[model samples]
Target: MRDFLPADKARRERVLAVIRERYRAHGFDEIETPVMEEYSRLHAGLGGDNEKLSFSILKRGMNAEAIRAAADDPAALTDLGLRYDLTVPLARFYATNRAQLPTVFRAIQMAPVWRAERPQKGRYRQFMQCDIDIIGDASARAEAELMTASLDVLDALGLEGGSIRVNDRRVLDAMLDVFGFVVEERPGVLITIDKLDKIGPSGVVAELRDRGATTGAVDALAAYLDRPSSAPSFDEAGIRAALPTGIPDEVIAHLVALGETVAAARGADAPLVFDPFLVRGMGYYTGTIFELAHPSVDYSLGGGGRYDGMIGRFLGQDVPAVGFSIGFERIVDLLQDAADTGERSVVLVHDRDVPLSTLLALKTALIAQGVRVRVEQRAKNMKALLERSAADGYASFASVGVDTTAESLELRPLN
Candidate 1:
């Protein structure tokens, strides 16, 4: 088990509380799911490239023996894996429980997800994901609300200065089609182009070339993706002026309107940027994609996209959905750096005059008063008790010995 010292636990809980309060204020209902889930539901196309990182389970009876035998073979059982992301499970949940739920469901979930990746500074084999998603809405207003809520949550968490970058998949798809790339190969192409930030323009070109994209298509894509965010603004007029050789004017108008709506939502305090190259990695995302990043962090703190078709795979009917997830562990690490170090006082008690029940009652009362309390166990004398409390980071102590009265207890502060 991972050991979380008292100080660390306190800090984590503080951050979590802020997140919960902000999400709750926005009308999102909290929901939870089991840590373990059947493998096939999680391993389907839902998880994207991270699907291989899932941790699977074993069953009992003949099935258990079969799983054990398959474990020996190494390649026999791949269906029973742990949930890789919360959105897929939420999609499954809505499909199964839709009849009992409202036409529009807004929910928040905070839980630990297991990933078998090599651990690093901020990356762990196990971590928590705090997510919010809205289902059954096709309007861009739902997308706008999600983005606003995400920014509010981060701001409430004390990330005073940051950016929530936004982009639409349709815009990028139009750009690709303009450059003569076939629609069937666009997903793979977008995946490679999304790596442009990690690998430079030349690297992206090389990858696209390796994937059988024509030189002309690769060159145009590289130029478009590499353009600076401030290269030029495209209003309706500018969009019409730059229309590709054979594309329809109506398509350009729709793309232009989408951009206008996103731009109008920006405020003076929190600015949104549009990057044509921002392609979220999830294969199921059919519309807009977004990511949150801070100037101090080297990677995205969190991200998500619109996956309107995901539910159709399970429910046999279309349910438009959009979601965003915060990397809970990463946020915790960031908040730890920003947290203030204040004195924490825990009252440690010992003695027989105060029966065990009375001591516990006192502890509970102190807790109700918002005071931290820790009853030291195994200390025989005041000196030992004080020393142990000091070592354990407690600043105060209360003792009830055999000679003490129930109404009058001894209290002391340890230096």
Candidate 2:
């Protein structure tokens, strides 16, 4: 839905380059998937709310009219949709190609995804997701490695002042049980809770009540939200004690161990915190989930977690998988905000009397000598044209007069 100008494009490419190098160094191989995927697969209850926002493609060919006749029934008219994210399509790709791929696959996916939703400040209907995933690894080490690589990318981009909020689905399930929330109502409850940061506590309580949550459950949640930690690192013991006493020991152990391991892997001054209420909206996440948030922004930069059963739905057997995605658009916005707009490029200006061949020869020589050069006949007043070209990223200017020879091409730096 947007076109990137030259400076914007350059900034985006710079961030992507950093991501690619970091992913490669971590032993991940790049892969791409079609932007369009079958609508059935996308809406198979995998993508959560993203499924509702998918842009579906209408049926085409000889039966197009027949399909349109049933436009009232959208299912009959559409069979494909623009992919909403990179994860599900990745699941399908791995399911189809697992036999040929290595038993342990480290994959990289950097591409744009489409969603039919209202655009916000940093949220776009079309934006790129840079993901790094490991399939076939069931251990917490996979999660640790993903955290390490993702954090390294943030560091490389000089994106400081952020914290990684970590939590597990099992912990959420245990807490819901303690509050007497039924299994069927947990998803809806989580969805409402995920919006707590956007709409305040009052909004979530209203939505949960509307969804038929018991008054007692809402009261308990309100009491819990009253004491949010002021510091970035959350209190682990405080969080654990909030759950039921008989909750599975493995749940606590897994969270504690992953926290310790990821912190160690992240090295000195690691920024990891435990947030019991960090409920990611995606239904596909089966285990650990984390979100990256900056103190200055109300939104998350990006997040991902273990979708152990997502691939199983396709391959008929589970494949342990974990991933993390950096918010490509948000990062670009930050970089652009801090960018210097000064131009370092050169341009060649000529008049109608100047032969086209002469301008071409001059441009070719400058390019051969390793210069970023642009050539154009005079467009407007010389001063206005030069000023406009400078704003468009041209730093130096050259002019060819009637008596000027190729050997005497003089260059002058534009102020």
Candidate 3:
């Protein structure tokens, strides 16, 4: 969907390398899945709105009459669709490869997913997703490890002022139930609450009422929303203080334990926040959910959560899973440009009169000595040529005469 120039590609690869290294260090093995999957699977209800945005691949060998016959159901004409996100593919992958994988698998998937999104700042039709997932473990440890490794990525990128906002879908369910909302209204209520950041508390309440939600439930939630957001802390007290009483003890305890586990690794210094209204958009998230936040951005850098039921849909058996994905496009820009890489690479500026054999020999000799060598015929404007080389990340350049040996070349560092 886009073209990355040499310099752009280099920077991207450098950043990806750092992410892969950190994930691998945490014992997650990288995995790859195809860019396209069966159309029916992509349309499964798990993807939320992303399903509608998927790019479908029409079935081959369909005659004109066949295409027309299926016009009423355009989707029937398609056999596959480009993946809208990595999680779905990861689910299918585990389902098919479970026997070859460990009982508890930590997998890394760094790849591009396609969508038909109206491209915007930080949003693209095609972009890289850096995900680390743990499947087959349903405990808080799975969520904590995800949070820990995600935070570690931000730290490695030299990104500061980052924090993780935590919440549980069960907590929302408890809130709705406590407020007297019926099960049928849960999804409608969540869609409104998820807009709290955009519409604010009063707006969310007003919108719910406009949508003809139950009056008593709306009032109850309004009162709770009006309460002071000043939390006690990120511990059990904090979790309870943020939510009303009657929340299942296990939900509260699990969230508290997750915070404690991550804190133990990152210390109390860990930047974790408890946001009761945090609703990740994916319909498949069955339990704990969270997003990566930085002070500098209004949107989450990335987010993930527990989808303990998703793998079951694929494998026909329950496999607990949790994952975190870094917003590669968003965070890549946030990171300072990579440090200059000129030292290890060199440009050989040669006269046009130099023999091709001489140029190849010189290039080979420098490459053997662990340098990236590029032979360029000297342009009329030597300064322009040197500047171009520097822009390409060459650290220095040396002029190569026909008679000059690799050792005799004098290297001059580029400006």
Candidate 1 C-alpha lDDT tens digits along 1-415: 1568765676777778888888888778888877776776777767887777878765444477687778774236654666777888888888888998878888899887878888777777777789999898777666666767777778888886667676667767878888878878888888888888888788989999999986788878677655554422445554444434544556455445545555566553334555657888888888878888888788888888899999998999899998989877888888875543345566646653547776777777777867778876545566776776665557777665644443565566787
Clashing pairs in 3: 342-395
| Model 3: per-residue Cα lDDT at residue 338 | 64
lDDT digits (tens) for residues 156-265 of candidate 2:
88886677888888888888787767788888899898887788888998898888997787777776666564443433474466554656778777776676777787
Best prediction by lDDT: 3
How displaced is residue 36 in candidate 3, in Å?
1.1
lDDT of 2: 0.82
Weakest ten-residue segment in model 1 by summed lDDT: 229-238
User: Which stretches in model 3 have alpha-carbon errors above 4 Å?
Assistant: 341-343
**Cα error of candidate 1 at position 404, Å:** 7.5
Q: Using Cα atoms with residue i matched to residue i, what is each candidate's TM-score against the true structure? A: 0.81, 0.87, 0.97
Report the number of backbone clashes for model 2. Answer: 0
The prediction achieving the highest TM-score against the true structure is 3
What ranking emerges by lDDT with the best candidate at the front?
Answer: 3, 2, 1
Give the per-residue Cα lDDT of candidate 2 at 300.
Answer: 79
